[model samples]
Target: MSRSTLWLLFAVLAVAARPAAAAFPADANPDPRSISVSGSAEIKVPPDEVLLSVGVESRAIVLADAKRTNDADVAKALAFLRASGVADKDVQTDYVNIEPRYPYDSGAKVVARLQPEFYVVRKSIGVRLTRVGAYEEVLAGLLANGAQYVHGIEFRTSQLRKHRDAARALAIRAAQEKADALASELGVRRGPVRSVSESYSGGWWRGGSGGWGNVGGGQAMQNVIQQTGDGGNGEDGTLAVGQISVNATVSASFAIE
Candidate 1:
């Protein structure tokens, strides 16, 4: 054969001898040699903000009268919250609802329900206090100044994203350590990360139920007058500004070599 023809023949033979690439990627199959691990982290920090849910309810024979009384009480509550150093923008109405209340008597026979005797007007407001030092003061004044109900109060931090990121980092570090330990025990080396996922929780975890002091509802606020004092102190002891716990968990998988 001619020299150029021989070179062409060699190229053809080399190409034919080369291994063919697989149709599917290497990672398409389950990594039987990989190890999966989970890690979790928890951090406790003080809350910098306070959220108070306050409401006012009024009833009267006339719907207009009921609404007017409710508006007046809610207005007073708003003003009280603002005066307690809660900014105007932070104190706003959450909801307004009006319903008819019927009067019924339990009789021996036919118990005909009387027509609605009164209309009930209810309005609730939410206040976010950036200054936690005034949390108790705002809670106290809301009830003292016409606020008929205290739905609940929550302590949280406005810097939620910052704390959550910190927790995530810690969880990831823990996951890496765990994977390294497992791989070492198996006498294998860790390869590229196959998959990773994370979940986090924080803020408003400890919520009060029912109403203020976990008492039934708005009617219960009437009896809480003594408890909602400016001192933040109760018969037993002083207020406890507890810390909030933030947690993050991560699931990671790595291939073993």
Candidate 2:
């Protein structure tokens, strides 16, 4: 080994011995120890709108006849809805289905006949009523005009976003209160929030009955509190204007000092 070779070898050894640089510097202010807690809140408000699912069904030996009759009934229903103050944008044709109907034997098997007996046509319409008070009148009018099958009805709140925000605020407050209570019980102090997360769930509930039936259609938490409000009928005691529930849940971690 010559002097230059020895010098190169020494340099390489020194470089190898040196510690590698870190990708990032250590956190100057490390996260403090945290206490986690979750809270939920529910707000009940009278529904401001109603959605009614009305269907018209027709059957005939000929497919065209069935479709024609169904179309006429659907037209009459739409006109009635418009006259009852429902806007064009609020009324929608949900679906139209056409299928062959076959005669079945007592054993629930298709009769030996290979050809279908008649054709069945079904048309479903969705009507949205902004005025909760007029739901009954509109519903009855729809049935009398052309609608035959009542698939389902749902009551909803037009101001759902506003109510949800309010509920979230309440849930956050509840979480803070819960954290404070736990800290007090453990003889420790609660510090600033270290982290926060949230979730939500809610639906319309009829008085005495469970949640409203829909036409087409979380992790376990402890220390949860729930409350419900009463629902009543309209002024005329005819329509049951159920209450819409807006719920929110918040999970918060606070520094323990």
Candidate 3:
């Protein structure tokens, strides 16, 4: 090859061999001298509302009959709820299931098919009660009206977002406190926070407050307290609406002086 051609080829190869230029600046690693700490805090508040889960199951030899029976039964339950002061807006249908029960013992293969010996229709609903005092009455009435099963009752509050925000602040404060304690133990002064990271959605945390063990460093945890119901007479006596917990965790890195 000619000298000028060889020189041009070498220059082009050199340019291609070089690493591609970055469109944005690369992220620098955090300060090595800084210490990372995580902290969590929780607040306990009395529940202001109760969530009740109720369901109905009906079965029949025909699909139409099964659906009609289920519809009628669910309407009866809904009517009972509305009459008992539950608004339409508060009653929500959670699920509707249509399943077939086959007679495996019969001369039928275990293949998946549409037709079956019997059709079972199931409907589930959620009821939100703002008044905790009406727990017993509602529980009993729901079953009497047509609810075949009562899944559970959980305590909750309307101000969940508000409590979550407060818990986050407490978490940050707890992180600062942890950093300060560690610095003191090492006989080193704690400097300003180098970086802080927090999850907006509080994590599921331990249920209780004031008696917390080593529970922190998570986000968006919900604690559900289930209240069991006995089928006897559907008479769930006055149930207590326990406290609800809001938890938060904060992770921070602070420089050392």
Provide TM-scores for the models.
0.76, 0.77, 0.70
Local accuracy of candidate 3 as per-residue lDDT tens digits, 1-257: 99999999999998778776543356554446877899898877666676777777788999899999989989998999999999899999888889888765565555734368899888877898877667668767877787766655566667888888898999999999999999999999789888887764422222322111222311112223333322111224434444556788889999998
Which candidate, 1 or 2, would have the higher TM-score against the true structure?
Answer: 2
By summed lDDT, which 10 consecutive residues of candidate 1 come out lowest? 222-231
Which of the two, 2 or 3, has more lDDT?
2
What are the per-model C-alpha RMSD values against the true structure?
6.8, 7.5, 10.8
lDDT by residue for model 1 over 120-173, one digit each (tens)? 888778888877666666666788887767786777777788888898999999
* The candidate that achieves the highest lDDT relative to the unseen native structure: 2
The global C-alpha lDDT for each of the candidates, from Candidate 1 onward, is: 0.74, 0.75, 0.71
Clashing pairs in 2: none
Query: In model 1, which runs have C-alpha deviations exceeding 4 angstroms?
Result: 1-31, 105-114, 210-237
Error of 2 at 127 (Å): 0.7
Give the TM-score comparing model 3 with the true structure, all chains together.
0.70
